[model samples]
Target: MRVVMSVQIKKNASIFEMTREATPKEIDDCKLVYCGHGFFDEADIQNNINKNLMD
Candidate 1:
Protein backbone atom coordinates (compact mmCIF):
# COMPACT_ATOMS: atom_id res chain seq x y z
CA MET A 1 0.00 0.00 0.00
CA ARG A 2 1.03 3.56 -0.63
CA VAL A 3 0.88 6.19 2.07
CA VAL A 4 1.18 9.98 2.10
CA MET A 5 2.72 12.31 4.66
CA SER A 6 2.83 16.02 5.27
CA VAL A 7 4.95 18.68 7.00
CA GLN A 8 3.76 22.14 7.84
CA ILE A 9 5.12 25.40 9.28
CA LYS A 10 3.21 28.03 11.13
CA LYS A 11 3.86 31.76 10.95
CA ASN A 12 6.07 33.02 13.79
CA ALA A 13 6.70 29.45 14.94
CA SER A 14 10.05 27.78 15.22
CA ILE A 15 8.93 24.16 15.48
CA PHE A 16 7.24 22.36 12.61
CA GLU A 17 4.21 20.09 12.45
CA MET A 18 4.81 16.67 10.90
CA THR A 19 2.38 13.96 9.89
CA ARG A 20 3.56 10.40 9.58
CA GLU A 21 2.63 8.00 6.80
CA ALA A 22 2.22 4.23 6.84
CA THR A 23 5.34 3.57 4.81
CA PRO A 24 8.56 3.04 6.74
CA LYS A 25 10.70 4.21 3.86
CA GLU A 26 8.79 7.43 3.55
CA ILE A 27 9.14 8.15 7.23
CA ASP A 28 12.85 7.42 7.18
CA ASP A 29 13.53 9.54 4.10
CA CYS A 30 11.46 12.48 5.30
CA LYS A 31 13.40 15.63 6.16
CA LEU A 32 12.41 18.80 7.89
CA VAL A 33 13.13 21.24 5.08
CA TYR A 34 14.41 21.26 1.54
CA CYS A 35 17.93 21.88 2.83
CA GLY A 36 17.50 19.87 6.05
CA HIS A 37 16.00 22.53 8.32
CA GLY A 38 12.60 24.06 9.07
CA PHE A 39 9.39 22.46 7.77
CA PHE A 40 8.73 21.05 4.31
CA ASP A 41 6.16 18.90 2.52
CA GLU A 42 6.83 16.07 0.06
CA ALA A 43 3.89 17.17 -2.07
CA ASP A 44 5.35 20.64 -2.23
CA ILE A 45 8.60 19.28 -3.58
CA GLN A 46 6.81 17.48 -6.41
CA ASN A 47 4.73 20.56 -7.12
CA ASN A 48 7.83 22.72 -7.32
CA ILE A 49 9.40 20.34 -9.80
CA ASN A 50 6.28 20.23 -11.92
CA LYS A 51 6.03 24.01 -11.96
CA ASN A 52 9.65 24.40 -12.94
CA LEU A 53 9.29 21.87 -15.75
CA MET A 54 6.18 23.58 -17.07
CA ASP A 55 7.81 27.00 -17.08
Candidate 2:
Protein backbone atom coordinates (compact mmCIF):
# COMPACT_ATOMS: atom_id res chain seq x y z
CA MET A 1 0.00 0.00 0.00
CA ARG A 2 0.98 3.62 -0.53
CA VAL A 3 0.45 6.60 1.71
CA VAL A 4 -1.19 9.71 0.33
CA MET A 5 -0.93 13.16 1.87
CA SER A 6 -2.66 16.52 1.58
CA VAL A 7 -1.86 20.05 2.71
CA GLN A 8 -4.01 22.78 4.19
CA ILE A 9 -2.99 26.33 4.92
CA LYS A 10 -4.77 28.69 7.26
CA LYS A 11 -4.44 32.39 7.79
CA ASN A 12 -5.45 34.50 10.78
CA ALA A 13 -4.79 38.24 10.88
CA SER A 14 -1.26 38.38 9.43
CA ILE A 15 -0.06 34.91 10.37
CA PHE A 16 -0.31 31.88 8.12
CA GLU A 17 -0.01 28.34 9.37
CA MET A 18 -0.32 24.81 8.10
CA THR A 19 -3.29 23.23 9.76
CA ARG A 20 -5.76 20.50 8.83
CA GLU A 21 -8.22 19.67 6.06
CA ALA A 22 -10.07 22.64 4.61
CA THR A 23 -13.52 22.97 3.04
CA PRO A 24 -14.19 22.46 -0.69
CA LYS A 25 -14.55 26.20 -1.19
CA GLU A 26 -11.12 26.77 0.28
CA ILE A 27 -9.60 24.23 -2.07
CA ASP A 28 -11.32 25.90 -4.99
CA ASP A 29 -9.94 29.26 -3.93
CA CYS A 30 -6.44 27.85 -3.84
CA LYS A 31 -6.90 26.37 -7.29
CA LEU A 32 -7.67 29.84 -8.58
CA VAL A 33 -4.70 31.47 -6.89
CA TYR A 34 -2.31 28.76 -8.01
CA CYS A 35 -3.78 28.09 -11.40
CA GLY A 36 -0.61 26.68 -13.01
CA HIS A 37 3.05 26.71 -11.98
CA GLY A 38 3.47 22.92 -11.65
CA PHE A 39 1.45 22.01 -8.60
CA PHE A 40 1.28 18.33 -7.64
CA ASP A 41 -1.87 16.38 -6.96
CA GLU A 42 -2.64 13.01 -5.34
CA ALA A 43 -1.99 11.13 -8.57
CA ASP A 44 1.37 12.80 -9.06
CA ILE A 45 2.47 11.81 -5.58
CA GLN A 46 1.30 8.23 -6.11
CA ASN A 47 3.22 8.02 -9.37
CA ASN A 48 6.40 9.39 -7.72
CA ILE A 49 6.81 12.30 -10.13
CA ASN A 50 7.98 15.64 -8.75
CA LYS A 51 6.93 14.45 -5.32
CA ASN A 52 9.49 16.37 -3.32
CA LEU A 53 8.41 19.98 -3.13
CA MET A 54 11.01 20.78 -0.48
CA ASP A 55 13.82 19.72 -2.76
Best lDDT among the predictions, by candidate number: 1
Per-residue CA lDDT of model 2 for 1-51, tens digit only, reads 222244354332111122334457865875422212233455644344322
The ten-residue window of minimal lDDT in model 1 covers 31-40
Q: What tens-digit string does per-residue lDDT give for candidate 1 at 1-55?
A: 3233443343432223344323566446653232232344566655654454454
RMSD after Cα superposition, model 1: 11.1
| TM-score of candidate 2 to 2 decimals | 0.27
Candidate lDDT scores, in order, read: 0.40, 0.35
For candidate 1, the per-residue lDDT at 1 reads 31
